[model samples]
Target: MAGGRKPCRAVTARLRRSVNRRPGTASPCPWPCTFYSVVAGHLDGGEEVKAAAIRDAREGAGITIAPENMRVVGVMHRRAGDERIDFFLVAERWTGGIVNAEPHKCDDLSWFDLDRLPENVIPYVRRAIESFHRGVWFDSFGWEE
Candidate 1:
C-alpha cells in the first residue's frame, strides 16, 4: 500500500456482451490501441462492495443496476506496485440505455465477448472475466512468491 495506507478496495462491474445492445463494444482509454475494460473504481469510504459496483455502473457507464441485478463473480487480490482488493461483479440485468457517462475519463463504451476478449484488454481484467466464466470465485494477480 502507498503511504502506509491500507490496501485499496475496488469494484469492477462487468457488463456481459449479451446484455449490451451491441457486441464487441469497447471504450478506448486513450491508449495506443483501442482496449476493452470493465466499469471499475475504488470503493467509497464506508461503502459496501455491492453498493460500489452499482455506483460505478451508474457513474462510469450510465446504467442503473439494482442490487439484485449485480452478481459477485470474483474477488482478486492484486499487486501492481501497490496492493488492491478487487470485487468483480456481473450485472445480469439493468434499466436504462447505456451511455458514456464519463466522457472525460473514457472515449466511448462498447462490449466484447468475454470468451474472445481483444488482446488490448488490461491483462488482469481479462483474467478475471475468464475466471468468472469458469466458475472460479477467487483469483490473484501481479503477486510474487
Candidate 2:
C-alpha cells in the first residue's frame, strides 16, 4: 500500500507451463529495456484480483486461465514514480495457444525455464519470480529505508 488512500492495483500472470512439459514462465518484452516481464495490467473498476489476472492473461497473452487454476504467489507494494500494488498469480493450467496479444506494446513473447530464467528480466519481475520460488508471499520494492 502507498501513502494515498487508494493505490492502483495490478496483476501479473505467471504461467506454470505454456503447453510444454517443462516447468516454465512466459512474458512480454519490457519495451525500451530489453527485459522480459510477465503479462500485467491495471485492474478495472471494482474488479476482483483473480478475475483481473484471468483477464490480463487473455488480453496480454492470448490464453484463458480458469480461476480455480490460478493462485496468488506474491504481492508487492511498489513505488516506481508511482505507488501500486502488484499481485503475482501463478496459473497451473490454461487453454488456447500463447501469443503476444499486444505486438505493438511488446516486441516478443517467450517462455523461459523456471530454473534458468534469462538475466534480463525486469528487476521487480525477477524479484517476484524468485520470491515465488522461495515461497515468500509479500514484498516491497523501489522504496528506500
Candidate 3:
C-alpha cells in the first residue's frame, strides 16, 4: 500500500443525478454517469465505517453527507495484484456541492453515465458498478476458488 498500513479498507461514494427529458426537446441529453468517486481514505483507528465514508466524501470531494443519508450498496474483495477491501456507498442526500478538493491526487473529476463508462475504468471498478446496478451485495475478485 502507498501508505504504511495493513488490512486497509477504502470507501467510494456513488452519487446519482437524474436527467429528465421533456417532450419535443431536440437538445442532446447530458445524462452524466451516476457512479462517481466522492472521496476515499484509509479507515482511521476507532473510526466507524459510516463515519469514514462521511469523512472521505468531505475531504476528497468537498461534499458534506450525513450518516443517515448514506447506505452500503455493495462491497468488493480484491486481491488480483493488491489486497484490499473496498466499500461502495450510495448517497441519496448530501449537503454542499462537489469539488475536487485534492486536485493534486486527481486531475479530472466528472459524472459518467453507468451505461457509457470511460474506457479507462479498472475492471474491478466496472464490475463493482455493474454489481451495484444489478443489486448484487458482495463480490470477490482476483482470488482462486
Cα lDDT of model 1 by residue, 66-92, tens digit = 998788878888887667888888788
Question: Which ten residues in a row are the worst by lDDT in model 3?
Answer: 18-27
Scanning candidate 2 in windows of ten residues, the lowest lDDT window is 18-27
Q: How many backbone clashes does candidate 3 have?
A: 2
Best by lDDT: 2
List model 3 lDDT by residue over 100-120, tens digit each: 665655555667677777665
Clashing pairs in 2: none
Each candidate's TM vs. the true structure? Answer: 0.82, 0.81, 0.73
lDDT of each: 0.71, 0.72, 0.64
Any runs in candidate 2 off by more than 4 Å, and if so which? 1-5, 15-31
lDDT tens string, model 2, 33-69? 4666777777787989899888988887788988999
* Selected candidate, larger lDDT, 1 vs 2: 2
> Where does candidate 1 clash, by residue pair?
24-111, 25-110, 25-111, 26-110
